[model samples]
Target: MRIYQFLHNAFLFAASRMQAAGLEGRKEEQRLWIQVNAYRDFIMATGQVYLFEDYLAGVAPTSRPHVSTALGARPDTTSQRVMALLLKAFDETPEPEQKQSVSLLIHQVNFIADTGQLEACEDYIHNRLDYAPLAIAHFTTREEAEAWLMGPAEPPSPADILIGDEYYTAVYSREDNVRFMSRDYVIEPYIEELAAEGIPPTAPAFETRAEAEECLKSHPASPFDFVSIAGEHYLAVHHKRLNRHTLHPVASTLTQWEEQKRVVEREEARYAAMNTEGEDEES
Candidate 1:
C-alpha cells in the first residue's frame, strides 16, 4: 500500500508539474492532468494528503545533488513540507505577504494548542472569541471549529502534528536552515571528460531533482568527485580505464534511492513467486 501510494504521488507530482509547465492541453497529458487532480481531490477530501506526503518524505532522500535531471521536488524542511500541505489545502499559492500571514497563523495555531489554551477553550475556539484566528485558519466558521474541537478532540488536520521546534524556527526566522553548504558547487568532469560517460547507467538514479542536489552537497566523497548529466549530480568512482562517473543517487539521501531499492525488491519477490509457482506446477 505504501509503495502504491508513493507511485501514485509520483504521478500526482508529475502531472501537476506538467500542468504547471503548460502541457495540460495535449491529449495524453490532458487525460493525466484531469485524473491526477481528481485523485488528488479524493485524497484531500479524506484529509490524508499530509500523512501521504509525510510518508513519502520519510522514504525519499533528504539530500539534493547539484546536478541530476529528475522529476519532483521534496520540501527540504518541516515548515516547507507543512506549508506545502497548506498550499494544497488552500488550493492556491499564497502571495509573499499572504505566505507570511499563513506562516504566522501556523505558528499561532501551534502555540495555542501547545500552551494548553486549546484545552481551556472547553468548546470551539469561536466561543473563546480570543482564539478566532485558530477558527479562521482552519474552518470557515467558529461553530464548525467549535464542534470538531469539542467533539473528536482531534486537530482538524494531520499536518498539525508536524509543527515542532524545527517548523516553528523556520516560521519565526523566515528561513529554513536546511540549505546547501557549497555555494560554489560544480561538477566538472575528469581531465579526459567526454561528451558523455559511455558507461551504462547503473548507479541508482535519484528520482527527484531536489534530492539529487542535496546528495551532491552532503554525500561526502574522498577528494569529492562527481559527474553531471543534463544538470543532475551523480557520484563518480574510477572504474576500468574510464574516468567517467556512474551517476547514481547517493544512498545516504535515499529519496529515489529508496524508491529504486523498493522497485528492485518487489521485482525479486515477484520473480521468486513465479519460480515457486513453476515448481508447484511441476509437482
Candidate 2:
C-alpha cells in the first residue's frame, strides 16, 4: 500500500463524503474544518491506518467523479496540511502507549511523482513499505477499511507477494447461453497470435464468477468449464478496453442477468448479516 496514494484517495473519499453529508450550506471555513477533521480522525482511528484521489476544479466534491489528479497537481490546503502533519501529530501529540502501538505508515508517493518512477513504484512498495511491522495499512475498499479497524492486523500472505510475471492477459469467448457464463480465458497457447498483433496481457482475471459476468456485460460466452478444486468455481472476465479486474453485468438474457444480480445481492446480504452478528457477539 503506497500510503501517499492511499492518503490522497482517502482525502477525496472524505471530501466526497463531506459533500454527500451536505456540509455545503455551512460556512466555508466550517465546512473545510469538518472535512479536514473528519478525514484526520478517520486516519487516526484506524490505528493500523489501513486506507482515491480525484478532484474536480475548485468546485466542491458534490458532483465530481472519483479519480486521481494528474501527476504533480498541487494538493488543496486541507489535503496538504492533513498529510504533512499526519505523522507529526500522531508521532508526537498522541499519548505514549498510543504512539508505540500505532506505528507510522511509510509512503512512496513523493518519490514516484518527483522521479516518474512508475515501474519503481511497485518495487519500492513491495520492497520497502509493505509488511513492515512498523508500517500502517492503506486500504482502498470500504470492506477493507472497515476490516482494518474492526479486524486484527492482517497476517502476511501470498497476496502480498508481487511476482511481476505477466504470464497471462485475460481473453474470453462467450457462450451464447445466458447461464453458461465464464471469463479470464487463458490463451497462452495462442500467445503467438496475440504477440503478432501487439497486445499486452489483459487485466488479471476476477476471482469470482459475479465479477467475470459483470466485465462481459452479458451472458458469459462459454461451454461452461467450471474449475472448482474445492467445490468453488469462479466466473472470470475479459474485455479489450474496459478493466478486467472489475465486475461487469451479464447481458445474455434478462432473466439470466437478473439471476446474476440476485446472486450478488444475496451474497452481500449474507456478508452484512455475518458482520452484524460478529459485532453483536463482540458487544
Candidate 3:
C-alpha cells in the first residue's frame, strides 16, 4: 500500500510541473504579442513624421513661408524635440524587434544628415522610422485624420446596380442570372461621373480603376461595379461596348453585395447548427 501511495504522489507532482510549464509558456507568448503590437504602433506613428516633412518641403519651395516655417518657429528648437517625448516612451519599453527598427532609423537619419539632402531627412523619418508628426499636428480630430488619410466618405451605392469595368452597368435588372467575371474590375469612368454629380474628386468612391482592380483580384469573387462589392465567385464577363472585361471579378454595388453576403452567412450558420444537432443526437 505504501509503494502504491508513493507512485501516485510522484505522478501528481509530475502533472503539476507540466501544468506550470504550460502556464509559463502561455504567459511568455502573451508578453511577446504585447511587445510586437507596441512595436508596430510605434513604427507606424514614427513613419508619419517623414510624410509630413515631405509635404512641408513640397509647399516650402513654392509657398512664401512654407508650413515647416511654422514648425521651425515653434519653441521646439529641433525636429528631434517634437519627437523626443514619443521616442522616450518607446525607449522605456521597447520590444526586441522595435529596438532593431529604431536602430535602423538612427543610422538612416545620420546618413541623410551627412548627405545634406533636406528631402532625405523626411524619407528617413517617414519610411525608415514610420513617424508622421505632421499628420498628427494638422488633423486634430479622427474625422479630419480619416479624410486626410483615405479621402472623404461619399453616399452609399444604390441597390440592384452592377458596375461595369468602365461605368455603372444596371445589373439589378438581371438579378438572378447576372454573372461576374472577376472581383478586381473597376470603372474609372464611374468615378468621374460621381465627381460630376457633385462628389469631390477626393471622395472615397473615386478610386483609381487600376488600384481597384488590383484590390478586387486579391479577393475570391468579382466585386459589384456600382459600390465595388465583391461577389462570391469571380466571373469575368466581356463587354464589347466598354472595350472589354480586361480583368476578372469586376467591382459591384456595395448594397446588393452586402445582402448577398448576409444570405451566404445565414446559410452557413444554418448548416453548422444542423451538423451540431446531428452530433448531439449521435452522442
Q: lDDT per model, in order?
A: 0.35, 0.33, 0.34
lDDT of 2 by residue, 1-283 (tens): 3444445554554455346546555455345434353433333322313221111122233221222232326555334433344344344534553332112211223222333433333333333222111112333443443443334433221111111111111111122211111121222222222234542233335565545456455543231212221233222223221222222221222234456568879999999999999999999
Per-residue lDDT over 249-271 for candidate 3, one digit per residue giving the tens place of the 0 to 100 score:
32343444556568879999999
For model 1, residues 70-158, the per-residue Cα lDDT tens digits are 11132352223333443442345345434433333333223323333333322332232221111112233444434443453233231
Clashes of 1: 22
Off by over 4 Å in 3: 1-82, 101-258, 263-283
lDDT of 3 at 168: 26
The true-versus-predicted C-alpha distance at residue 55 of model 2, in Å, is 33
TM values, all candidates: 0.20, 0.23, 0.20
Best by TM-score: 2
- Positional deviation of 15 in candidate 3, in angstroms? 36
